[model samples]
Target: MIRRDLLLTLFGIGAGQAILLAVMPFLARAYGPAAFGSYAVIVAVAGIVATIAALRFDLALSGAEDASIVPLSRAGLLLPLLTVPFAIAVLALALRLPFGAHLPFRSDDLSLIGLIALFQGWVLLGSALSTRRGLFATLAAAKIVQPLVFAFTALLLLHDLSLAMAVGWAAAMAATLPAWRHLPSSMGWAETRATMRRLWRFPAISAPMALLDVLALSLPLLVFAGAYGERTAGNYAQVQRLIGAPLVLVATAGGQTFLKHAGDRLRAGVSVLPLIRRFVMVMLALAAVVTVAVALVGQPALTFVVGPGWRTDTGFLLLALLPVLCRVIASPVSHILVLTQRLATQGLWQISYFLATAGVLAIAPRLFGLEGTLGALACSEFLLYGAYLVLAVRAARAANPLPALSSKTRPLSASS
Candidate 1:
């Protein structure tokens, strides 16, 4: 049942992501490098802000089985709500600054940035709730609708890439409102307040882990932008978006399903070692397949999607990061840590990775330029996969000591 749900969810998400991936290069070409650069900046800022505003509630929601959606919802709303007013004030203040006078775009762009941030926050929150309820189909359907709306609307109403992104995101969020109606109506002020208190108890540990995870994934782009410039960042982002579709669709959908079941099994004192071992093996195999497939067809695929003149270097970057396949494979193990409430340990590992990767990117860029930065990123992922493997082994062993060495048990080192 879990596998079925995962497959369905992946199909839906993968399809949508694939479409977006195909469209991005065309969009980049049509908009030109500067517009693409602007799009990247807006996305980056919005992504970071949205991560902060969500306050790690999305991950927290995966672990929450309590009947207090109201509090969870309230807490989710409050953090982003606070940001809305502050963002306005900051933008207002920025307009008064001398630096603001030198910018190409008006103060209104800041408002648009804030809107994107708020929309992302809501999307994350809504996604958390949807995932918790096993509303995989609904969530998957929403993912599909968002991109189509964004694509068509951008191409039709406003040919501006940045505005298209903003509109598409807003429309997507608006489309997801119906999904929220599926949640129980028992949510209220009292339930929301209590859930907030309970949630706060763990955010100190989980928030950083969540932040690190996002950083680990996102910081590479920033490094690319800083070292090579926005054009380079735009080019790399195009590939990342393409490759990320399958990685997220399969790995993420599987991780969510695994978490729901694994949590229940752990609480019931079921041995999850065999399951973890099987999961690890499956992910490794899938990663291998995806890596090879992408390597074989990636260049032609990119050309076909985005048209001529789009940088082929993006394909090389995608091929370079192919080892991230292993990282995607190991995602379930990380999800298990969250389920087990070992978020502090998880956070520590992720933060260590972020710091290590950031340091590498900073130093490497001065030495080798864009290629050097990509090399740093690849090395960082390899190190992170090593760490994740160790954690997964320890977790599996701890989850079922009796089955520690069963033939069905695959050793983590062996898997590596």
Candidate 2:
């Protein structure tokens, strides 16, 4: 049953990426690299904002008691929703600044940011709600809906592909149910505030951690583009997408299942260390096989599909192998922090990761150029994820040494 569930989830993710892959040629013909660059920046920014808006409360869903889930999820949304106006003000200011030019925002782009951030927050929370309730199909449906809609809209508005990208993103996200759905949705300010306080580490530590991680990833595109040229940045983004497609195929399914099942075990004070160790072994083995296979086939595959100019730039696929391996292995188990409420440790890791990558970007290029710098960054992440795995194991065990818990009582209906 567990294996079947994992395959189903992977199928959903694979199907969505397949659609995006099929539509890529059409999108590329319609919009130039400059437009895609702009779209990438906007999407990256929206991802950052989504993390802030949802406040990492979703991480707690699987472990949270039923009564706590509704109140906590609702409360998390409050911080972001209340700050929406401020976000808009910042968006407006960012557009006029020279820095925003690289992000290539238009007068209308701020609205897209606003719409995407709002839609993404709810979508994230809704997905979390589904996961916690064991509504796996909803999660599967969500994986499909986003790109299916994105492809349709991209085709329909080829003239305004950038706007279509944002609109498609919002449309797909809006299709997900909110975290508060089926709940009475009547928590008073006092209760909401209380709930927020109870889950304070998520918003306070994890949210910023998420944002910094985003900056670490997204800021590079801008920096790379500035240092080299648009082509370099565009190629890097393309390589990332191609590599990420397969990475996400496994990561998404592994992460959701790990969090749900491992969380259940921990909540009952059961040790998942065996599972974590075995899981890590399997991912590392898979990584070794993938890295070697890609090294052999990557260049030929690129030239055949994307044509000749793409051959030189796809080195990133090989360069990123170590980090991608660490990603798949570490990410599935990182929810240990949520289970342990050890956001401070995770926050520290993020800060170090941000600084290390920034340093690598600044220094490695002078000595070895773009490809070498990317490798340096990947090495740093590889080390960080190692530390993460050790910490996660220790934390999970430390958090679960108490007497075993019995089955929880049924959660009260929404009105309670």
Candidate 3:
């Protein structure tokens, strides 16, 4: 079942991501690094806010019941609405203040940026609502719809590049309307507020982890813009997005599969150690093959597809990926922390990682430049992920009271 769900998710998400990837070259041509850099920052901010706005109530969808879903999603849905307006106010005021210039957005961009954040929260709500109803296909379809709309809308809005990115985000989220329909009717303001109080731990604990996790991606873009320049931020954003394409696809599939199985296996006293170890090994080997192939033809390929202007030196690219490489290994293992009910521990690690990465990206660049900073960030991530894997394995071992693996234990293969 784990393998099957993973394969289906991969295929569905892979198809959608492929279309998104296909349109990126055109979007890249339409918006240069500086413009795209600003767009990246906007998108990143919206995404970060959206993740927190949901308060990870979306995460409780799979195990939660109908009575639980409404109030949770209602609270999540209301968050961005209330917060975005305040955020816009703060951003507007900030732009008038001394540190305003340091921000990634313009005064004109603030309202749309806030709206984008609001829409992203909607997307999160839709996903949770859909998942609660077991509408995985709807989730998958929405993934595909988002990028196509983004690419199409981006081309049409070439005159206003930043606006294009913002609208594209909104459009993508809107495209998944059906998924949101699965959300149960609101349980009234009083009941919803009560539920929020009930699930305070999600906000207190998982929300921080979610925020830290997002900051891991957003902080770098913000720092790159601040430390280097808009162009450098754009360049950094480009590399992260391009490289992450394949990595995230696999990670998303692995995550869903891991969550799906980890619960059942834990309840059954089954060992996931062998499975986790095998998953890591398989990923490493796959990463090696992909890395080698990309190294051999990456430059030419980028030039041919994305154009020569977007190309960076092969050696420079290779040296840029301490964080990226760490993510490759760690992303799959992330679900384990959740499976083991280790949100507090995971949040601490996330806090440490965000601080470490931000510190390195900020200070290391002055001493060792881009490569050194990336390397430091990557090394920190490697250590964090290593500890997470260890904890996950320990938890798995603790839960496995069964004598040993038997024929009843289904392998990750299909034949069984």
Candidate 4:
């Protein structure tokens, strides 16, 4: 049943992402790279804002039991609900600032980005609630709906790709509220507060980690924008959007299912090492296949989608990034660490990677120029994957004890 749920979820997300990947280059070509870059920056900012609004509640939901659904729902809804106004205020301030005002878009872009953040927060909350309740089908459906709406809307409204993208995401996310309403209710105010207290502990550590991690991924675009201008940033952003398509599909879909199953296994007193190993192996295989395919077809694909003017010799860089994509695919390791109550270790590893990547990026631009940025990214991936692997192993060993030391040890017995 768990395996079926995993496959279904993956299929749904994969279908949605395939549509997104197909439509994005067309959108980029229609709107031009500068507009696409503006879209990327807006989305990046929205992601950061939504993360803040979520306040790590979704992370908490991964380990929550079915009985905790009502409390989790209340807490999840309240946190983002409370944070949205503040997020909007901050966004407003950002728009008024010289930096934000310099964006190659209109004031409506700010409003659209803010709306995206709001919808994203709601999705995080809804998805978390659904996971806690084991509503995998509903969650999968919700995810599927988003990209379908986005793709169709964008295709129909081809003139304004930016507005089309924003509207599509917004409309799809709006559908989730009704879906969430269908979930079984299980608690009231007191239970909500209790759950809130437990979940609140996460953001204290996760917030810093989330911020640092977002900065690490987003800094390259920021740097490109600063050094080369919006046009260059736009080109880089378009390539990144294409490269990220497969990665996000695998990461989000697989990672979501892994968290639920791994958390269940841990709760049932099952050893988590085998699950981690299996996840890593699967991710590595997927990444390898995708990397090779992308290397062979990426240029032609880009040319066909976005026209021949878009110059991004990022195939080598994308190939070098296979490890990072693999690492992202196995992101559930971090979730497992959190589930096992090892937040400090997880936070430590994340911070270390961020700091290391920042240092590398600092020196990279001077060395290999554009390619150097990619090199730095690959280096960061190596550091991150190594750190996570070590920590995940240590965590599994500490959780199970017997498997860590014995060379001939059999797989830990499944408990749940």
Candidate 5:
């Protein structure tokens, strides 16, 4: 079942990656580094907002029962819709702040961030519900539609990268229209309140955990834009996009599958350790293969895809590989924390992750320059995520303790 679900999810991710890879060359040629940099900033801000827009109630939907799913899904949708105006207001005001002058995008792009967040929230809710309901095909379709729409709109709106990205995100949400039909007509205030209370841990714990995780990812882009320049940030962003596509694919497929199966095992009183162990092995093998392949052909491929004069440096790619690989490994089975009700432990880790990311980004650049800073960031994260994997294993064991050995089962002698 896990294999089948993973392949279905991978099918969609594969399609989306193909679309993105096909159009990247055109996008690189048409849009300058400065433009790409600004677009990256827009995405970064929108990503952070979207992470919290639903207060992570969407995650709760994954393990919800049939009768409870509708109300939870409805509440998830409503939260983001309600957040839209607040997001716009806060972002608009932020752009006028003194530090706002250091922001990468112009004032006009602030609204796009809100739009992107709203749409992303919709997609998030849809995906969780779809995964819970075993609608991998629908989930896959949504993935394909997002990149397809983004690619087409991006080509058309070559003049406006931010707007094009927002449009593409909007399309992803639109593709989830079918999924929304599965929601309640309207959750009552009492129902919404009750649901929120019941799932309080998600918003209180999971939301912040998710927000911190995204911020860790987004910090480098924002810092790069402010500290380096748009062109430099753009170059870095492009390298990330290229290297991250496959990671996203593997993470998404593995995560969705694990969420479904692991949740089942936890409910059935089965040990989740075996599943977690399998995922770790798969991710490690994949990371090793990807790192070697990219080392071999990443630079030439980047040059061919995005053209010359745009700093498609292999040094950055190589430095980014280790950290990204660590991330991909942890991300797939990280849900074990949630399934095992280890939110507090997960929260502590995420907080440490965010702080470490900020510190490294702030100080490392000054000491070692861009390449050296990336190397530092990569090494720090390797340790952090390595620790996280250990925690995951412990959490799995704690949640599902091993049975005691029977007296008949004697240990074998070393000589034997």
Candidate 6:
């Protein structure tokens, strides 16, 4: 079941990402590093906003009961409306403030950022609802629709890159309308409050983890822009995006599958150790392959695809490889922490990771220059992910009880 579902998702998402990847060279030529850099920051901010927009109640969709689904869906739907507006206002204000002035994009991009974040939340809601219903095909189709729409809209709106992203996200959200239709038109505030109480961990614990996780990912782009410059940020953004595409594709598909399966296994009193082991091994092997391929061809490939003006180099790829591979291995399986009810431990790790990332980015750049900074960041992430994997394994082991021993459970005899 996992293999089948993962393949369907991978195929659909792979195709969509392929389309996005195909047009990227052309887009790079049209927009150049500066614009792409700004777009990366906008997208990063939108991602952080989207993570909180629904307050992460959507995560509760894993194996939710029918009695609980409507209110959860409603919470997922309406929370974004309230949260996104407030977030957008805050972001807009930040853009006007002195420190925000360090960011490359103008305040004009705020509207696009808000739209993208809102729709992205809706898209996440849809994904959650669909996964609950086992609607993998629908999810896969939506995945394809997003990047395909983004590619076309990006070309058409070459004059405004951020707007194109907003349009693309909106289209992706539209594709999930069928899933959203499953949501109740209304839920009483009392019911909503009760439901939130019942699943309080998602909001109180998982939400913070989700936010910190995204911030950790986005810090490099944000820090690079402020400390380095738009051009350097853009160059980093281009390489990061390229490295991230396949990782996202696999993680999304595999994470959804594992989330559902692990939840089921836990509910049935089955240990998820074997499942976790399998997933971690597969992802590790995949990451190793990616690291090797990138080590060999990464620099030349970037130069050929993105053109000479961007200054693609082997040093950046080498410095980035360790972190990227570690992330690929650790991220998809990290959800095991949540499934095993280890959110607090996971939260601590996330907070530590974000702080460490900020500290390293702040200090490393001063001493090591660009490559050294990246190397430092990579090494820190290597340690962070190493710790996270250990936590996840321990949490998974602790979630299941030890088997009982009895005369009936004795080892098989030679003739038995």
lDDT of each: 0.68, 0.69, 0.68, 0.68, 0.81, 0.80
Clashing pairs in 2: none
lDDT per residue (tens digit) for residues 130-227 in model 2: 77777677777777888888778778754665466666656655555643467775766676576666666667777789888777867667677767
lDDT of 1 by residue, 1-416 (tens): 77777777787787788778767756756776555656776676667667767677666676665555546766786778886557557756876898766333356667677877888788777777777777777778767877877777766688866667777777767755765785566547776665666566345666656666676676766666655677777677666666754575577677777776676676567866777787788888877776777678877877777677657654474645564675777777677666554555676688888788778776877887766667666767877877887786676566642221122333333222
Model 6: CA > 4 A from native: 96-98, 184-189, 400-416
User: Which residue ranges in model 1 land beyond 4 Å of their true spot?
Assistant: 21-25, 84-109, 182-187, 313-315, 318-320, 399-416
lDDT of 6 by residue, 56-167 (tens): 8887777455667778887888899999999888878887788777775577877888899999999998988887777888888889998888778878755767788888
Which segments of model 5 are wrong by more than 4 Å? 184-186, 400-416
Best by lDDT: 5
lDDT of 2 at 18: 84
What global local distance difference test value does model 1 have? 0.68
Indicate the worst ten consecutive residues by lDDT in candidate 3.
407-416
Candidate 2 wrongly placed segments (more than 4 Å)? 76-78, 94-108, 178-181, 185-189, 307-314, 320-322, 401-416
Clashes of each: 2, 0, 2, 0, 0, 0
User: What lDDT tens digits, residue by residue, belong to model 5 across residues 56-101?
Assistant: 8888776654556766877887899787668778878878899878
Compute the lDDT for candidate 5.
0.81
Q: Please list the residue runs of candidate 4 whose C-alpha ends up more than 4 Å from where it truly belongs after superposition.
A: 91-108, 175-187, 312-323, 400-416
A best-first ranking of the candidates according to their lDDT comes to: 5, 6, 2, 4, 3, 1
Winner by TM-score between candidate 4 and candidate 1:
4
Best by TM-score: 5
Q: What is the Cα-based lDDT of residue 105 in candidate 4?
A: 39
